[model samples]
Target: MQNLEEAELCFPQLLNISCKKHIRPQAEAMFIYIVLSSISLLTVALNLLVIISISHFRQLHTPTNLFILSLAVSDFLVGLLVMPFQILLTEPCWLLGDLVCALYYLLNFITLCASVFNMVLISVDRYVAICDPLHYPTKITAKRVQVCVFLCWGYSVFYSVMFLYDNLKQPGKYNSCYGECVINIIGPADLVLGFIIPISAITILYVRVFVVAVSQARAMRSHIISVTMKHSSTVTAKKSELKAARTLGIVVAVFLMCYCPYYCVSLSLVIGSSTEALMIFVAFFNSCLNPVIYALFYPWFRKSVKLIVTLEILQPHSCEANIL
Candidate 1:
């Protein structure tokens, strides 16, 4: 019963209210959101600390550390650049103009793609190191690491541009709620490109890496047993190899834990009409969980924490010596 001009004026406000009502829960949903947000913030802070410590400390600049540094940087950026906007813009209407919304979406896609690809590269690097230790030096040199990092950024930018181009061409297809950026449910293309392909590739790489690592561990144990025929020495080397294998396994496990649910939620959005807002929140939570996983499993991070604690305990004595 309204004219076109009146309808246009009223539409955005209506959409905004709808978005807020949907996100503002009675009780349970708010609790979940708060808990997840807390976890995410904590994870981001931890990753930031880890990255800063590794970068500032000269002793922690090995190849393995370099890969970890890359991972931490990606996680930190996701936490900083993507999650906060997503959490704040949960209302049905976007307060930031269209330009800002578009830019945020673009950056979100780019950083996520970069993170996933970096995981794949890390897995491949681990595979090479475990499967062929001698050739690993030639295959995964510092130069190669730099090249891989460069390619990750380049590929992320290229694909992100393509995605943005496609998205901008059909802006009307998306539901522009304040809190949600629900793209039109395109065919399998979105699902495949956004979630399935990257997850599958990473999963495959990790599976192969696991198989190779287990075989290597067994072979190394057998070799040690045969060489000195001393159980104690064999046990020590076995423990070292086991520790290394466990570290790699934890990395893969963390990747699966933090990302698999996100991919599932994304696929569900593409394939069905479910709660897009909830799914987006879940995916955001994954970005925050990565740092917790690192803290639990990463040996270098654990060592760094201990070193920090020790230095703090020794600080007073060092200060007194300097004064004297």
Candidate 2:
């Protein structure tokens, strides 16, 4: 009876090689499951709302909104596909086979990379719009943004496949026992390709953006000092540019806050235990927070959500309604 009770193997029939399940307290596990599941559901719902709002409203079809739409799509997939599986990972045993596990992480990387790329595109869009307002319309058109979004997803797919080639080719390569799902890709490659390079690019772009924004602010102040009616239209355009820079700046800041800790740990090669789990979910939780950021900062997003919820979007010609 003692030996039978001590045998806590994930696969009872293959007890010799099977992974031992570290059974957490039932109540604790249940609570964790509930919380993570709720987060996943909320993430899916919020991002879906963002997706529906931007995609359905013709008035929201501007170049900037197109970037938002692409971002929401990536976050939506994170919620829909990635979060559920992530929940499974938190568990003690991996009932889903090794190939599925590899594929799950692969999808995870793709969605995350796509989100990062979308943010980069957004930063570039804002840079041009704010710093070079005259050429913005010509440079950052709807068609061009669409092409960029497609390429972002395509690149993400290729990168993820390339990074996880070994794991995909030979599933369970890292698992020492049955019913364990773990992939240990080298840190240096991920550190550079996933974190350092992209982060450096974003940092440089934002620095340039900030310098231009400060100069624009000074110029606007000078124009106000002159107090000329002829400069009224120019003042309004400058105000719009400053407002855009501020809003997107918040978006970038929030993204960095969420992602930085996880990457820092990865770069340091100190990932383990509950701290690692917390860091990962902290990053994942950013997906849920992004749409909320839009709601708070973007009046158009709030208006569009109202239209979507009230079934007003179903009305003919509703897409033409002035959301801005």
Candidate 3:
């Protein structure tokens, strides 16, 4: 009995103060690890492709693609850094020391904030494109998008520092035993700054976008009936309709499906033992889904993927190749 008890302790040498390791069946543990690892790899690969596709292709250097590149970079970091550490979080004990754990969560918060802000930028981009197409070119320039991306990341860093300042000042302050790693951001601050405000903004913007989209759709149908087929402006209107449809699908799925449940559960402060991990995984899974959505909906993404895989991207003047 003593042997079994010692085996269950995360640090057997520490005796009473050591955290008790939660052992699972070997097969179950292996299955869970395999699944999570696969997701981590997939997330990393997909986001990397997006980063490469946008960065390398000159034709993709528009304001919208620049926003996507920023989003991809954050998601890439999440997969590369955050998701792997999350796997560690699922382990019976944190093998890494308290300071590393603190820093890990710090990075996680920064990336999460960056992703949220990037989404906000994306929403704004789509809003202008759909609702005010005539002025979009002047209003949403590449220079402005680049500035927004820079500010988004800078704010994320500052916000995360403020959020984790206490924990950083006293690492392991919340740990009750050796071999454990846990820290909590202030609940009210997290709820307000991290969840409530951003979500509200995204919701309001999307609602306005939806309302405009409906009105425009009706207008387009009536215009098509009055206009002749030879009008090239009708083609431009049809293209805008398709872009709006794709943007709507991506925005709704990403915000509602991936982010909403996690924040709701977190803010509710009623994380079920069985559901907490699943909720977190769902949130991280969104990073991977974004690129896949692009691949499915954007032909340029498919073409870029093909070029990248075939190593044609290395050919002379490949960057200038007509992807559009």
| lDDT per residue (tens digit) for residues 9-28 in model 2 | 88888777888878889999
Q: Among all windows of ten consecutive residues in candidate 1, which has the lowest summed lDDT? A: 315-324
The CA-based lDDT of model 3 is what? 0.85
Answer with 1 or 3, whichever has the higher lDDT.
3
State in Å the error of residue 70, model 3. Answer: 0.7
Scored by Cα lDDT, where does model 2 land? 0.88
Each model's lDDT: 0.64, 0.88, 0.85
lDDT of 3 by residue, 23-130 (tens): 889999899899999999999999999999999999999888898899999999999999999988888989899999999989999998998888888878877877
* Higher-TM-score candidate of 1 and 2: 2
Evaluate residue 20 in candidate 2 and report its C-alpha lDDT on the 0 to 100 scale. 86
Q: What is the TM-score of each predicted model, taking all chains together?
A: 0.75, 0.95, 0.94
